[model samples]
Target: MGSGISKARRGLLYISYNGKVQKFMFDRKATSRDIQEQLAISCGLTRLSNVILKCRGDVIAISPSMPNNTPQEPYTLEQAGYNVSANDIIASTVKEIGKQFRQAFMVEETKREVYNRVASIESRVEKDGKRLMEMEKYKLDLVELRDAIYNKQTNTLDYNRLRPAITLPNHFYCPSTEQESLISMARDIPAYNKYVLTNETKEALKTPQFDVWQWEPNEMLILLEEMYFELGLVDELDIHPATLKRFLLRVQENYRNNPFHNFRHCFCVTQMMYVLIHGCRLQEVLSKRDICVLLTACICHDLDHPGFNNTYQINSRSELAVRYNDMSPLENHHCAVSFKILSSPECNIFANLTPEEFKEVRGDMIILILATDMARHAEILDAFKQKLDNFDYSSEDHLNTLKMILIKACDISNECRPIQVSEGWVECLMEEYFHQSDQEKKECLPVAPFMDRDRVTKPTAQIGFIKYVLLPLFEALNKLYPEVEFIALESLKQALNHYERMKDFDENKKKLFAGPVMSKSGRDWYSEKQMVDEGGQ
Candidate 1:
């Protein structure tokens, strides 16, 4: 029992030589002398007790009775004869560790692959959505192009003769592509091509062919195509391809003569309609369908006008005016003629519309066409302003917004059109008005404003018309459509400038007519007159 070794008030040691086991119990406080005394007796090293005590805390102290056997040597845990080295141990552990790390890396790689695959799928879905949107946009563009072409062809058609045929290709086509294709196809129709080429030459030459050349059906179609292609791009309004082709054919049959409602006028109106729709941002107010209907109305609003106003027809007691009771007589006749043509099974451009949609479209068409009467312009604008002021735009019912803006925009579209286009229209209208004036003069009837045949130019009347009528109407429209303000302002400015220039002309004329020769020196003339008066007396 290692001489019952004990450390003074610090620790106690117990050694069992029989079992080769040792036990130690530490004290909370012990001195170095206690450990020296215990080790000296327990290890039987009295002579080297001091040396053993010096190494005490450095090495684990064992009682001599607990460790009297030979020192045990360490052996490899693996098969000893197999000659396993420290490097082998390290290599084996590294391989196991590497295997775990590789497994973890594989899991991370798999997760990354899955994540990448999901991302690829999401990207594809986004691309597909964009492609679908683009396809829909193209379809709409195609529809609009088709409608424009149809309206142009229809207005050019001669109603008295055979109806012009407009063949629409079924395949998807862009306007530019279709135009190029049509130009190529034109070559096959030799007579049609010759007529178009000749007409083109005449226009280029600025020849007076209006009264001389009769408009052929194919020639009319070609012109329609040209006008349809010329209008700027519009996104919202979409005209059905079939409807457009059929409408053109019907128009050709309905207005065969070079009537007052010619294709050129329709083209101008259609172009104006596009400007109004886009320039006003009317899409914010109106539906795409409503816009389409409005455009259609613009094209056919003055159809079969007979180159005369209601007043003329009423004064002449024309059958059509009499039949319609002389109230918007020309407009009424035009609407009836257009709707009648539309009612025909073969001429129904709006055939594809549902009953409700058709009703709305027909109603909108009637409203717009009737509103085009210059006499109604003031009343219509008043009503439009009242609606604009009273109506709440935030209301859930967007229909009112649609009606108000569409009607207002159409009524004043001419004021916002390009200067060149507006000027062209003014000239055409002036020519028409003058022609009516001439007829009225021959009949000994009262001439109205521009319709006065005796008037040299009626520039004052022109200025008055723009200042009082056109400017006010456009100013109201500009409030609703700010983008068109610049255009309308420019147009008004140009018109007013022209009026001022014309007024100056009138002033200069007065000065020329009232020459200095007409008046002698004031005092000298009076003196000469006095002598003649005295002689007479």
Candidate 2:
């Protein structure tokens, strides 16, 4: 027979040498000499003959009288009473082979004991390894949960506050309350008039024609505070003017410098809300608390916007989406940041409000902010339309619906501005839209048809949006307040006419250059736009 056997004839054996145990496979019929030679080569030993192989702490011996079992005979492992199937350790020591023989009665006991012990040890080791891996994975998960849900340093979830406090604007430093009070006192003087707006600016701000593009950031900040004062919110809400200034400053600080959804868009929306309140005479009709809620919601509606819409958040499975479970993630974030600012003692403009009042305001603000999500446009418009026919201002439900419609109207009211002003906003919106589309292309996500700059022209972009979204919303609001038709609806209609003319010009230009016509696919584009807009922000 050959010294080596096929895999099927090989059985496992454990070997203990140099204080370490290792597994080895041996032929089932391998003799002591064959094993000794193989081990010597495998273990890098220079000599093999002098090695003593022990089973169960005694030397393996063959009786001299046994056939082929003389003291020098090469006996198979089974002849020495070792079961290759048991995979028992063959303990070897580097010494002369001993002449001792284990009694016959002990052989069976030793084989069974070795098998049980080896099997037990291996089973335990495998189970322990798996347990260790599981425990390690669990530890990592706990640490992640702890970090995400709690502040490690504070060891508490500071749910009310956002970390790394809002940055103070230029020309302002972190001032002590004493200093702030003194500044407020000085500002109360008529001579300290730098923050005051011109009569023309104030009057202009009261109308829809107020041009946001004409103001600088600092000027806009002052305008916002002045608007709050002009609305009597500062007095009715018991807002400390100094505290209000700080809050507005922090609000400005939080808005990112995106192409469109930055501080300017925020101011424009709030200004439009102001225009709506006055244009519709809502100040006389709506409660003071309701007007306060409307204005505050408009101010903080798009706080800290990252410029990407909800569709991207959901599609990309972004952190914000995961944080809010993909339900109006941006709107939820806006509310969180808004309240985060409010939670700060220095910026808590609503501090004078009772707990119940604060809760009511917070809830209303959340509703208004979330209503700005374009996906809810049709739902909110329909609900408002339903209420307009009954039009009971005394009904809490009807009043709340009007507040929602007002904020929604103001949020997208750029189209209601004068043509020159509205055109500038369209450019800004286009820039932001194109940026998002470009990112979608880079990330291999579906780009919104209207946002794809290559597929859409300026006129095409605004035309469908005006026809489908803006006119319907404002026209509904006009039903409740006929005065709004002249104030805002006229501007919207003029803007629509201007874009229509521009669309014709664009088509003519395309015809002159032999460019592909978009009118052929106009219906498809508008349909896809509505679907995506509903699914998107």
Model 1 alpha-carbon drift over 4 Å, by segment: 1-240, 252-261, 393-421, 456-458, 520-537
Worst lDDT run of 10 residues, candidate 1, spans: 73-82
- Per residue, candidate 2 scores C-alpha lDDT tens digits across 1-537 of 653768666655555666555555566566766766665555556433334556556565422122222232222232123234322233332121232333444786799899999999998898789789979989998776556667678789755442112212211111322322212211221233467678999899989888888899878888988888999988999999888878887888777677678888899998988887787788888878888888888989988777789998899888778878999989988887788778778788899999999999999999899999999899988999888778887888888888888888888888888888888878877887887788899999988898898998898878898999999988888888898888788988898899899989988875644432334365456545655777943
**Per-prediction TM-score to the true structure, in the order listed:** 0.51, 0.61
Against the reference, the lDDT scores of all candidates come to: 0.55, 0.75
lDDT of 1 at 416: 45
Model 1, 153-195: lDDT tens per residue?
A: 5665343332121122222112333422321211122222343
Looking at model 1, residue 495 earns an lDDT score of: 63
Best by TM-score: 2
